[model samples]
Target: LNMANMDGDETFESTLLGEAEEVFVERIADDECILIRGTKNHSSASIVLRGPNEYFLDEMERSVHDSLCVVKRVMESKKVVPGGGAVEAALSIYLESFATSISSREQLAIAEFAKSLLIIPKTLATNAAKDATDLVAKLRAYHNSSQTKKEHTHLKWVGLDLHEGVVRDSVKAGVLEPAISKIKSLKFATEAAITILRIDDLIKLEPQKEDKKYGGCMDEE
Candidate 1:
């Protein structure tokens, strides 16, 4: 094989050289052509193979399953049974209106039935509290009566009056504590509610600068 072309410099003629030309030719002859050809073919084959096209699809399926599981868990965990009757009633009225817009008449009926079930417990709690308050007031008044009462009846009334008084005092004390404490708690709750409501508002509002004196983007040019 000609060794001059393999050397890098085209100006050097291999035939004119003696021992240097022989050594270069000998080194080139020792290299395995089979090994070089096998390595190049293996690399080309690997590039054409494109192993595991489903790998990304499998990853996306797993991600979707995990996301759906999280959503299902969240929906299952919600246990707050609507507190106020008025709030429930209001929700029912709104939901009823929503049900009316449904394309399916059967679905609208189901929605109405569900809203009716939700309203019952809320109404019961409200009625129970109202009854308890009225009964407590009636017992207090009867016990305070001066006319022709037995000793036990008067004593029972006195005990009832004392219990009512204690409850009244406790409630009054709770109301009278530092206005600052109530104001701070109110402020915190208000701030949290406002923050939740104004989240989208923040995105809509333009950024304002506190100091016009320091100059703005308009002054950059």
Candidate 2:
């Protein structure tokens, strides 16, 4: 069959090698790119990005890479957690309770660690131009309420709804993130912080002194 976009001088000849239920062919603009459809399985595909400048193209490439990473993460782990800082808030609450059980001096560190987790939600609320203190308090209340519930079904995935400028259930709002990614992020961040704290040596740069006279005590007129 000849496509409508085909020129009179150009001809496509093919024998009926197989039978298919349906087929679709369309010619793309001046590029003459042909799009074929009605296939049960697609083994490969092409991605084309067009932009007026290199900066935009670079950004598009990075965005595409991140999207692919997320897909691969989901495929490999097959597990996800609530996003919008819900997980962080929940972890913080748990850690706080855990710190209370410890009577040793180490409890201070654990308590601080628990407070550190709130930075995620605080940063999110700050970025969204909402009242970070108020929203965080509300989020803490939601998580605490969920924790006190006797039934597992009452558990909530509470987090900030940036769009609404309030706290809500992240899972119900469709805010989700790869569990592995979140775990890796926390692991790496904690390790880096610990490493910095373990370092004993400190390097400081001394400020340069201003010359009292211009070139060997010479005074300007």
Best-performing candidate as measured by lDDT: 2
Provide the overall lDDT of each model, using Cα atoms, as 2-decimal numbers. 0.40, 0.82
Per-residue C-alpha lDDT of model 2 across residues 1-221, encoded as one tens digit per residue: 65444455654457624444566555543365655455555666567777888799899999999999998998899999998888888888888999999999999999998899999999999999999999988888878777777563344587789988887777887888998999999999899989988999989999876666664465658
What TM-score does candidate 1 get on C-alpha atoms? 0.19
lDDT: worst 10-residue window of model 2: 11-20
What TM-score against the true fold does each predicted structure earn?
0.19, 0.75
Model 1 off-target regions past 4 Å? 1-82, 121-221
Residue lDDT tens for model 1, 15-125: 663331122122323352222222322333211112255696577677777766645544665422212222233334445556767788766654755455343333443
Identify the leading candidate in terms of TM-score.
2
Residue 217 C-alpha lDDT in model 1: 40
Residue 44, candidate 1: Cα error in Å is 67
After superposition, the stretches of candidate 2 with alpha carbons farther than 4 Å from their true spots are 1-40, 50-58, 151-155, 208-221
**Pairs in steric clash, model 2:** none
